[model samples]
Target: LLQGGDLSCVIRERQNSNKLFSEVQVLEWFIQLLLGVRYLHKRLVLHRDLKASNIFLKDGTLKIVVIVPGDFGVSRILLGALDFASTFTGTPHYMSPEVFTCSGYNSKSDIWSLGCVLYEICALDLAFDARSWVKLLMKIVHGPSPSLPESFSEELNHILHRMLNKDPMVRPSAAEILKLPYVAENVKVRSLFILTSL
Candidate 1:
């Protein structure tokens, strides 16, 4: 959704779940992702790298093709990665700690990042902005994240909290998140609440 040109960091941050981006706008984008994940999980395709900046919005009101194919980060040609579950990869703001510890990771790791994405958009701030490899790794391993804003809907807060849980195996998959009531029936309404608050 950003206009083309080499992006300026300031402009990038402003677009990153900033208060001006409207929660509904964020939610709408998320809903599309959820649907995409649903189809992807069904195909046994896991995106591994998902973040606010990577997710794109075209019509601002489109859906049905939710997954935004062709950009699953480093997995584009591998069909999946070797040692896919353990390679420490992905962006810091949304990457799971396991992705860095060299512990190897998987689709579940992507779900965790998805949680960060949800949290970032609602807060209109990146979860963790690290400056170096060590710092980024340290943050993912032990940093406190951007907390759920006090004004958020209870359902949105709940969904985000659930996603952020540290155990990769325990984290819900996109398919699973989609089935949750918050994602299923009320993204529009709860998301609308976020938009109005801003």
Candidate 2:
């Protein structure tokens, strides 16, 4: 069992204490999340509801040991490479614009949700929020894309932007994202660290 609670709880606690997570910590979690999502995608699984509440941390010695994406209740398995899931499901703030159009969405939709999760990790708040569902839909479908704070690195800013692109086809695949220099270095270091720890 995971002793540490979900990411939402961690973000809430940090917000309550007026302490934001450091860039390194956030990147560590982000890379791990990408790895987890990439693994799922490799098996043709789409985690429809990718949100902070669904990501759990395994902690040891008061530090985040592992980041695990849970809650597969709304997930779907694509039968083939060309298949897509057309159902409208997932948290509004994390849903992809294409999902809103009811046209159908694939792995790239999950990339969009990953972008939302990354934004929340950095901003400690929802990337797209509204008082009503209609307003939220409008904002997501037409409003300008949200951005990371000025303090974040340009590489991260670029990644977030690409992941949240209005066109799903433009978004990078999970493997492509992992290949980025910024993300690749982190993944390499993290892998070594895990290896040494074992």
Candidate 3:
């Protein structure tokens, strides 16, 4: 367990945090998560379930949050380098269309789920919602993709749209995502912080 706690606790600390993430703050969180995902991918692991509750944070110094993903109950390590994985796993709200349809999938599925997580972080609401399971599934498979508020920066909106692309092939790989302007810009800012601190 993370010494600080999970991100859900972080979200809970500020009642309206869901509605109030600055672009820089959200980009930093996304960069941290993408780095973690890149580590998992390099090791051929797939964190099938990636949501707010599943992400843990360091215990001390709550000012600068550190995300440590937890809950590996449903995660899997691929036996081969092909990257394809079985379907029908992961939480429905975060599940990609391929998972719902039992179509062949791969690590990109995790990207889809992460997109949903990022969206929730920014919007303070799940990307997909419905009164029932069937409707939820339908919404995920056929409903229009979720959109961010107009207040979000154009770059942030662009990256999120790519992340949430319905077509797995179209979504950026973790590595590719790490290279996006938004992510790269923050990485430099973080590096500057480290260097200056030293």
Candidate 4:
């Protein structure tokens, strides 16, 4: 059983308490998220409805936190490497541009959702907000990508931008994102931190 509850709950509690996550904490969660998504993609699974609320955290031994992606109600399994899902599914706030456009989407769509979750983690708010689904879709399709808070590192900002890119082709895949220097370094650092803590 997961002890820490969903990420959205954690973020909400922190926000209510006027406390924000440190950069290290955010990076650790983000890297864990990417690794989880990478594993899903490698297995030909598409978690179409990835959001902060769907990710759970468990307290591990030695105070380490383990992140798990859940809520697979809308997930699909691709039959081949080039396969894509056309049905519209996923939370509106975290939906990718292609998903909003009714175009076919692949694993990259999940990456876009990951970007939205990451933004929410940093800002404690949705990246795109509107009174109606129509306006929300318009903002997602034509609006400028939301910027990370000034306090976040520029490297993170860059990574978020890449994931939120309007063109799915331009967005980096989960594996590609994990290979990024910043993400890779964080993975290594997080590993060392966990190891030393134990």
- Candidate 1, residues 10-114: lDDT per residue as tens digits? 236666545455555656767767776666666656566676555654444322222334544454222543436555555666778777666767677767877
Give the C-alpha miss distance for residue 177 in model 1, angstroms.
Answer: 1.2
Candidate 1 RMSD to the correct structure? 6.1
Per-residue alpha-carbon lDDT of model 4 for 1-198, expressed as tens digits? 226777888878878877667777788888878888888889888888889888878772112122224533688888886998999887899999999888899999999999999999898889899999899999999999998888899999999999999999999998998899998988888789779999
TM-score of each: 0.72, 0.90, 0.87, 0.90
List model 3 lDDT by residue over 99-139, tens digit each: 88888788888898888878876776788989999999999
Candidate 2 residue-wise lDDT, 72-100, digit = tens: 36788889878999999888999999999
lDDT per model vs. reference: 0.64, 0.84, 0.77, 0.85
Which segments of model 2 are wrong by more than 4 Å? 1-3, 60-72
Best-to-worst lDDT order: 4, 2, 3, 1
- Output the lDDT of residue 77, model 3: 77
Candidate 4, which segments miss by more than 4 Å at Cα? 1-3, 60-72
Model 3 clashes, total count: 3
CA displacement after TM-score superposition, residue 131 of candidate 4 (Å): 0.6
Model 2, CA-based lDDT: 0.84
Q: After superposing candidate 3, which stretches have Cα over 4 Å from the reference?
A: 1-3, 16-19, 59-72
